[model samples]
Target: MPIADLLDRFRPGASVYLPGATGESLALAQALAADPDRLRGVEVTSCLLPGMNGVDYAGLAPDARLTVFMLPAATRESFAQGRVRLLPLAYSAIARHIAAAAFDVAIAHVAPPDAGGRASFGIAADFSPIAWNAARQRIAIVNPHMPSMRRGSSIALAEADLVVELDGPLVEVAPARPDATARAIAGRVAALIPHGAAVQVGIGGAPAALWAALGDHRGLRLRSGLASEELLALADRGALASDGHVAGIAAGSEGFYRTLADRDLIRFADTRETHDAGRIGREERFFAANSALEVDLFGQVNLEWQGGRPVSGAGGAPDFAAAGIGSPGGRSITMLPATAKGGTISRIVARLSSPSVSLPRNLADVVVTEHGVADLRHASLDARAEALIAIADPTMRDVLAEQWRSLRTAMA
Candidate 1:
């Protein structure tokens, strides 16, 4: 079906699911933003996409509501007051919640029309399929610019009610090379990574560096989220080879997508299978590497904040951590640099900023920083505090100590 004709099917107060980081259609988002009153709420995957804007409905409608999974509520600066709302949920439950008729409309992207009349969902496949089925109406911003993902589930173009065909670079988020500090932490975290483990590594600098360093290791397999450029490199270089790489999507440079086209090295799996704990726990040596905003004295991890604003979404961090630590020989490691902003912000804090993402200290086993690693499993809060402080940036040690003392006294 032609795209413009399909878009006319949507009614006001539509619960539309926008494409996430990879398949995001900026044109569609702008179109929706232009008519904010038509949308009751917009559901998004995350707010951290760089250079991409106009998705959040701030000025478009003063009364429109937004439903996001674990991202902070939108502020007036970004969105209108009372326009943003948050749905607190674990990554595991996001699909189920959406599938149960949680939204009225959904927005996504599809590949160019194929001979079979089926177009792939491209890279952002996690909860999208679930939402697409649940929405009363579905709108797809068809883009030939996106690499036609040969893997994962395919969506039938004949079924969608709205389709907008446009050609432009879908938003690209390139993984950054870790700095010296992050590299040191990644190395310590990598030391704990064992062979034949099904691992889930989070996005950003530390995981990218860890992916590069894993070149020396062999026989490591992945049974987690999407395969990034560094991970595909490991498979290509023979450092890491999965019996099969299981994931819902893939995001990286043009080179990364090219490597994914290789049938032998990459095979995409549905989220129901990839993120399921029962399925992942069967793997013998599961390992997960994730980032953190701050690790408190008692080993809590907050991956959702920056300068008091929520910069990330609650992705598969908790799900992968639980599966990795619960596996027979699995290990879950949280890696982070000791500080941010050139010594102004301490990555290790006495307390989490309001709105905690990862709670329950026992869930995480190892926390790594530039200075060293802190194994927090089965340890007391006081003991965990000591170990966490030990690995914090040296320059911030005194400040942490003072903060810790105050917190301790307050608890007393």
Candidate 2:
């Protein structure tokens, strides 16, 4: 009935399905944070996306153990302490895991009820529907500030056992201003995308520049896991179709959220709908432009692991990559800068030293960097290595070529 009661349930160590990313409810999180004892010995599970949700749940509850799909910076300390366990799952697989958990409570942040008595999942719809449906108890923070999403994303408010009314600012991603390098990389990606294509572009400076580069594109559809603020600019320029943009979640400034609600630009979809291969395959031109930490000579991608630990989850990238690569007329494009770590390290490596290969070489149709584009589709093994090395940072190219030769010699 009230948030006080909700906090009471949490203190007793109820298995909670507190969603992160755009589904995060700052109201409930603050309420629990206000009383540290409320979180003691609690077991929390979430798919807290890296770089999206920064709350340190284990820090708040000293005795609490957390289970997360991705390792965000906020949770790194806990992870290092063995208080957090990671599940390296795809976006669709994460939904399946949440369904199996049957958590005691599933708390969601939703738009206030409309005249039709339905509360929209609003800014976040990726995994909320699955959690809400599978949990033994349902709670919703009825946030007036949450965008009122229209379409199949709304749920009846009566379904939630506890409905807490809260009016406060939601979590947001600061708007990204693409730099010259990002713009150059995005320019190459823009040229590869045809007008009227459905694109799956993720967040960050490169994607923001991708939208700016497509300023003249018409009738484009955005089918991405998360919507960046750049969607507004595209919509303003008539580059994006009115009803063509859809995403599983929205991450941007609060002002962007308001404009999205006012313009009804993004239709939020569940993970099943957004990541469905069959659904994406049906789209005429499903070009997925995703970021990767590194790509080896064979074009294998590593998007998750860095150093010796997991920094991010695979999420929907694999789903969209496979779907886009398999799409009859669509191509899967992986975009990244030529270097990382302030230009000291090469993103194009001779071999993926990371223990994880988030995406296989088969899904790598094209690789784009500020330097140039590498079309690896239907290429031979030797040809693939040469093409990838050609696009590598000029200084690193020689080193990578030597490494590639070593690999080939070893293979022989």
Candidate 3:
């Protein structure tokens, strides 16, 4: 069918759901944005918009609104300008939210059908399955460049109501190269992981460094929201367990996607399975490593706000952190540099100035900085504060300690 013809199907006031990350249909979204008349008053919802197509949300017709679950660099400006709606939901709850909202249309990028007429959801499978099941209209942009996978990660052609076939490259994200600080934090985090552990790694320099530092570990398994090149390298090196890895999405260079093509070593499941706390808790020696913008004396983690403004969403950090911490013989680790802004600002503070709390103190097991690690798993309020302040940047440790003491005195 013609791509323009498909745009005609959208009705005013309709709710449209699109997958985020690399699963977004670039050509289809561009076509939709180009014809504002067809999309007038339509509500388009998606997460982690990479902004590869250069679609201007503010330029879209006045009635159309773009709702984003996770704020990306491309949409940050628009969000600040009040041109986009931001919904803060963890990756695990996205499917439920979409289903409850009863979106009318689902647009997804998928691989071409195989001999069995099944198409893979490709690099992203986070909420697509749920969106497809809940939406009244199912539309797919079939891209030959996408890799086809096994049963659990694919959808049948019979499910799609409209199909627009286009051959193009899937979106790719270059891995964050770790620096000296990240490497130091990664070393401390790596030391905490046990052999034959199931790991969940979040996105950022610290997690990337941790993945790179785990080459020597044996029988590691991945249960994560997003898989990067480092995860591929581990599997290639025979360091991962033979049981295969579990992921909700894959966001890496083209080489990483090719590695996943028709391979059974990694199984792409929906967020429901990948982010389920109960399921993750069942894994032996589960370890989750996440990055944070700030950690306060009370052990609260802030991953979203910067300078008192919303910068990102919670994503899967909370789910994985709590699950990993609750699992038997498991641990949740948060890593970040002790300081920012040329060491002028400390990331470990006596109080969080931001409104968004990614993880509460109770869920925090370990906090790691380039300077050292703070084990808060079984610490009292005063002990937690002391441990955290001790691992802060040397220049700011005394200042944080004084602030903590003042806060304690005031409470008393």
Candidate 4:
């Protein structure tokens, strides 16, 4: 049947939850333009990458309109003049919003069928699981290009109201190139990780390099949102699988995609399970490592914003940090270089660059860099500063030390 006919089968006037990235939701949004009436009350959360490339209601259909829950960068004066809608919510809550019946339909991209006839939600798993829960109708665009991840959740074909099979290339986000400073920060963070510990890291050059550096260690486990190429490489070398790697989804190079084809080491899981703080607390040797855009003397780390611009959201930071801290054998380390723009600006500041919780001071166990590690657990602001300054780049140590002393004197 044609795509239009499939839309006809579903009910109208219901809120729809679309994939944030990975093109599953973008495809549906495109098709909905053909019949604007069907999408009168549709809502979607997308990174808007697909829509940014001259897509969305206008490109899909001149008459198409929607209430889009998009990032600030995704909206424009032209979009505001139209029926576009925007909702500001943290990345972590997008799924919860949908599960609470905030949407009527869910259009998602999923991996192809597996041996047990189950499909994976490859790469991006953010709100897709939430859509799975609350949407009255579930529609999946089965893409062979998506890595067939063996994640935790298994949905029956019967549950899906519609299944659209489309062969297309998977959405790939390349890792950013890290300068010397980022490499040093990654190295410092890597030293804090002990062998045989379960790890959770986000995708980035810093985190990827940290994962690669783990080659010297034996028996490491991984638990995270987007699995990177370097991490899977560790698994291939028997460094991770020998211990255990529990991950929600896999994202990286073609080699990483092909590695996901082998299910023995990598397993896909739901957010509730993968990111459960209480469950993570129970696991011994849980080490959660995430990046920070900025850090303050008080030890608060910010990963979301830079110069007031929204960069990324708090996806699993809170959950993992809390879990790592609560875990008896685990520790949460929020890692970032001491400076920005090739030593032009200091990332370690007298106060927060802004109010963001990449790693709140209270939850942070240690902050690491090439200079050294700051053990912040139960430490006072002054003590934390001392440890952090020790890890500051040699060039910036004196400057940070003076700033720290100024703050300490004022606080006293």
Q: Write the per-residue lDDT of candidate 2 for residues 1-412, one digit (tens) a residue.
A: 6678878778566888887897888877788778878888888997788777888887787788889988899999999998898988888788778878898988888998999789998888988888899899998888888988776387788888888888878888887888999999999999999988999997668888998899899989988888888888888898987676789888888888888888887788888888887779777889999888899999999988888678887878888988887787899888889999889999999889799799998877899999999999899999999999999999999999899889999998
Q: Can you write out model 4's per-residue Cα lDDT over 218-288, one digit (the tens) per residue?
A: 77877776566676567666676453556655555556676666655666665666777888889888888
Off by over 4 Å in 2: 11-13
Give the lowest summed-lDDT range of ten residues in model 3: 50-59
User: Model 2 — TM-score against the truth?
Assistant: 0.97
Candidate RMSDs in Å, in order, are 3.3, 1.4, 1.7, 3.8
Clash count list over all predictions? 8, 0, 0, 7
lDDT of each: 0.69, 0.86, 0.83, 0.66
Ranking by TM-score: 2, 3, 1, 4
Residues 1-412 of candidate 1 have per-residue lDDT tens digits of 5534644544455555665555567666666566555544333333223322335654356545555554423333443354555555666776667677556667667777678988777766776777777777777667886666666666888888766787666655577778887788778877888766666887778888888877778888777676776776687688766466677767776556655654445556556677787678777889988888788887778876676666555677777888877888887788888888878888888887747656457686889988998988877877788888899988888888888888888898
After superposition, candidate 3 runs with Cα above 4 Å error: 49-59
Error of 1 at 178 (Å): 1.7
User: After aligning candidate 4 to the native by TM-score, how far in Å is the CA of 339 from where it should be?
Assistant: 1.3
Query: Model 1 off-target regions past 4 Å?
Result: 33-54, 61-63, 70-76, 139-141, 162-164, 262-264, 355-357, 395-412
Better of 1 and 4 by lDDT: 1
